[model samples]
Target: MAAIPAPLSHTVAAIDAAYVAAARNGDSLGVSMSQVIHPCDRALFYQFRWCAAPEPATGQRQRIFETGNVYERRLLDMLRMIGCDVFEIDETTGKQFRVELAGGHIRGKMDAVATGLPEAPETPHVVETKSANDKSFKAIVKGPVRETKPEHHAQLQLYMHAEGLRRGLYLVVNKNTDEIHAERVEYDPAFCLAIIARIERIVALDAPPARLHDDPTKKGAVECMFCSARAVV
Candidate 1:
């Protein structure tokens, strides 16, 4: 006789449980470069300290993250197809290009470094990849990533600075339309220095810094609304 199959709910629960188990442990010994640009100082502190038990992403959220990873690989392939010399791994380290600062308290990994682009074939540029939903994609397409997505712009700047590169390529994929947008970003030394100093200050602090805002629901507090440390802060 054929065996019985599990119920849909049970199957989904099992999958979600696996994702939760596979999630990165919330514990951190230092501040991640990814969080260096966060607008809220206290939120970054809380994350660095793991003050509140970090909640693992929901099953749906985990799937969404995986989807972004899938697209990242595709983006790398497309760059190679266009004759760009893409280096996803560092030969020296035999791993992804990594940046660490502030006595290793701040760290990050870049997506890749590419050379031989049509615009500036001679210059090596840091490559950053992203995937966006419809609304976010539309905002990016409107132009000026520095304004529409300041965090992403800051991230690329940090990557370029760490890699000693003067230029970066920001490639974003629109999930809804399958459209890709590419932009060339120039490194800003002043911005990099400012943020680095900011990271060092935050890492050296003994307690959480001042909250960006008192009311999480107030106008322009959108970031606060979703912050994990909202209650504690």
Candidate 2:
């Protein structure tokens, strides 16, 4: 008889344990630009103020993040293969391109900046990448990033605004099918300015803003379902 196969469960458990062990909690560095676009102001306030501790990232979540990083690297390589001049780091600082506002409280990093695109050879554009599962990929493919994924759109806009660029190259990969969707996103000054104003106001507030809904089950309160501050707020 063939030797019994080792339990796959043990290997799976070890992988998960490794990811959990390496997870790090976020610092109390003002509001992240990535998070400032959250619809619920109170939630943002609570997060920035550290009123409630966020749940540690699950092993599965870490794995997903790593997968996204891999895809992003591949996307950048493809740009270079096509003769685009891609800059992933700022030469002066030897760090990823970053943006800060609200006295350095609101901050974010750009994935890359590239020129020599097939459409615009001379114009430099901020590069942003994302990987989504099939369902999400379908939704985003249906409409522009601003309409389908406002948070992502907000991030790209902020990056371009800080870089003083007029356009951004947004790329998203379908994790399931390995398909890519690319779009050119124009910077919206009005939108960026409004968000910056809100960030400044939030940083100065002594109290949390009103909840999007008193009832978590309300139609517009979907974000309340997984809110880290749900218990405290």
Best by TM-score: 2
Winner by lDDT: 2
The superposed Cα distance between candidate 1 and the true structure at residue 212, in angstroms, equals 1.6
Q: Least lDDT summed over 10 consecutive residues: which range in candidate 2?
A: 25-34
- The local lDDT score (0 to 100) that residue 135 gets in candidate 1 is 95
Candidate 2's TM-score reads 0.92
Instruction: Write out the backbone clash pairs for model 2.
Output: none
Question: For model 1, where is the 10-residue window of minimal lDDT?
Answer: 25-34
Candidate 1: residue 225 Cα off by (Å): 2.1
In the order shown, the candidates' Cα RMSDs to the true structure are: 4.3, 3.6
Pairs of residues clashing in candidate 1: none
Per-residue CA lDDT of candidate 2, range 1-233, in tens?
A: 99998868887888999999999875788787778799888888888888887677788999988999999988998899999999999998999887887777788888999999999999999999988999999999997898999888999999998889999999898999999999999989999999999988888889878887799877767799878888874
TM-score to native of every candidate shown: 0.89, 0.92
lDDT of 2 at 57: 77
lDDT of each: 0.85, 0.88
